[model samples]
Target: MDIAFFTDRRNDLGESPVWDARRGWLWWVDIRLNRILAADALGVVQREWTYSQPVGSIGLAMGGKVLVAAFADHFALIADDGHAQPIVAPDIGEGAIRFNDGKADRQGRFLSGTMQHGGQAEALAGVWRLERGGSATRLETGMKLANSICFSPCGHWLYLSDTLEGVIRRYAYDPETGALGPREAFFDCNTIGAAPDGATVDSEGRLWAALVTRQQIGCISPEGELLRTIDLPVPFPACPAFGGADMATLYVTTIADSGHKLKSDHPDAGRMLAITGLGARGIAEAIYHT
Candidate 1:
């Protein structure tokens, strides 16, 4: 119900956010800044690591000291001291194809999707799964702007969406086989005139989606009903995560000026934000087992 600024510095395009329960720190990425950052609970940026390629998204590792990251063209395990171990380079094709939103499933497999820079109609993007021993597999294809990826707490459902399609699809997940059953159109963001961006699941199994095109965060019930919408302070919210000691605080990342190729000077546009008093708690994010 209340949106508060969490950080002072602005992020050009902040994306995926994950909370590390072991360290009580929140980690996120500035997609265009080519960096991964971790902040303490008090909003102090503890670690800022920059790389040659963009850090598309990040996931917690089993020990909580190392992080699993989805780089622009590959996946890597980054240590607390900023050391990076290059993992397998997924076959995402060439030219403008790069990784985007990603999250680890309940089974400890890291799942990330790619986005084609200019091929919206071709649907050249896909979702890939990475196992503990560094094995990779392409699970699904035919996506445009891969976003809104998360799994239910019970590990039975996986949610995914392409920002350009305006539709979020839910897949029946089989953890043992690492296979996804046929997907069904779970919810249409077009109904709200907003495209869903990065999303997460609450302990109650509700999906909280960042409505990028609109200045709002939409919460949908597990049955695919839009339960309510929360007003956002900025126009382009990139993602949301549940953190804090109690997992009751909702943190959101945003896009500042030059976002979507547009320019604006809203003071709080690109800063990290926190929302509280919602009385909702979140399930612990699945860690990527090494």
Candidate 2:
């Protein structure tokens, strides 16, 4: 696997890479900076936007004109001009929890998870589903450091994780009603000595998960088997998404080692990487509707 730099800037907590094939741009967030950025295929930042709150993750909306983002406190629609349009404010597990990693399902419903700063020892973290019309609903509870949110290509399954437990659970998803069935164990990162951070499913239904602390990306099959791992030089790869001219390149977001749970010094920790020769194609990210 050949990994190359995608951008010159370092992100404290870079995540949620989304590719817009129609526009030939890549979008992602720098959580610590509360910034969202869009870059060209060559990694030149063409446009940048900032927000008042930490941007946990972003889902494209209005054909990439607006971004559906999970701000630390609430969900909002952010425009190219940096104007934030308020959306439904769901309960953020009281004051201790703030919204984190989010993804839009095939049907365009946005789902986000709330997590405690340290962990879920407080037992207040939860997953939420937000509809296009500003209606939000609780999907799952009893979580900690939720991440790795992605759905099956057919929209019948959803994979989410509570990073503290190093496990990603699969649930039977209701695409029509935005309902989730009981969750069952899907993939465990314990085997790799890491925790699941973020993930995305490819067009072939294979799940590519960023295994934080392990310095690698793990690919799993639809049957929940760890197929293989792509090693990285950095210590904490926070998120992974497939994008590029052919949608075969894997773009990864990373966390700075200086800011990791077990902080250390690593020069390349916060930089983003574009990996090639993965031999996988990705589905276009589902944009948030309305």
Candidate 3:
């Protein structure tokens, strides 16, 4: 598929591509830069917001606000005016841990995962669920790089990836009670020599995952079969989201290579990419309940 540039500016670690249907804009974050950006469908800059600490990911919430997983240490609700209110603050003791990738579940509960900063090997990282009334619960633990958090279209399964291990796992999910059963190995990327970074489910229930090291996105059948791959110009595609007027466009966020070398080698390494004519549509993103 042909990829088009959606942004000129580059991000050090651009992750978390989300579509704000209510505002008709695409939103994403530059994790290292601690900035959140919103742009129009035509790749025009609409607005930019920055926070005091690294903003890992964002989930659309009611009242024109966004639920933010900030600095991997806390969760907050941020408004368009840049005002924020603390929701849940988990004490991740002094270590190299911080939030990385996340999204809302089918039932509007916000879920985020943590990663060891600088790729350090630490067992403190894990996945968390932010309950409706500002409560936090640890869902999974003993992870190094938690990523690729997405739910099945039927809302019956939850998928997560441990990038460091190069494997993605699936869990039986309860949309109503936010309960997750034991995880089972879904796909192993080791054979492909790549790690799964981020993912999203399409309207047809196919899982599209960003293979960061392989420079492509893999579309897997709901039954865990390899379906197809979408090649990208850059080497590090951090995350993918389905957006656009008809939700047929696939938006991807990439990160700059080590020492920003890809900025010269690829040029489009950190810029957002929009892929169209994919012959598939995306399910609407679930809004976070306050």
* Candidate 1: pairs in clash: none
Better of 2 and 3 by TM-score: 2
lDDT of each residue in 1-290, candidate 2, tens digit only: 68898989787888889998867899999887888998999999987887777888889888545789888878888877878887878766566568889899999989988778753356778788878787888888888778889999999999999998899899999889877888899987887787899999999999999988888999999999999998898778889988988999999988884243744368877889999988899999888997
Q: What TM-score would each prediction reach against the true structure?
A: 0.97, 0.96, 0.95
Clashing pairs in 3: 72-99
Residue-level lDDT of model 1, residues 39-114, one tens digit each, is 9999999999889988888898865447898898899999889887888998888887899999999888899999
Clash totals for all candidate models: 0, 0, 1
In angstroms, give how far residue 57 of model 2 lies from its true place. Answer: 1.1
Compose the digit string of candidate 3's lDDT tens values, residues 1-290. 56888978787788899998877899998887888888987788887878788888888888657545555589998877767788878765466778879999988889999887555555778899988777888899998889999999989999999998999999999988988899899999887787899999999999999998889999989999889888888778999999988999999999885233334356666888889988889999998877
lDDT of each: 0.88, 0.85, 0.85
Segments in model 1 whose C-alpha atoms lie over 4 Å from true places: 63-65, 257-263
Would you list the clashing residue pairs of candidate 2? none
Candidate ordering by lDDT (highest first): 1, 2, 3
What C-alpha lDDT, on a 0 to 100 scale, does residue 164 get in candidate 2?
Answer: 88
What's the distance in Å from true for residue 41, model 3? 0.7
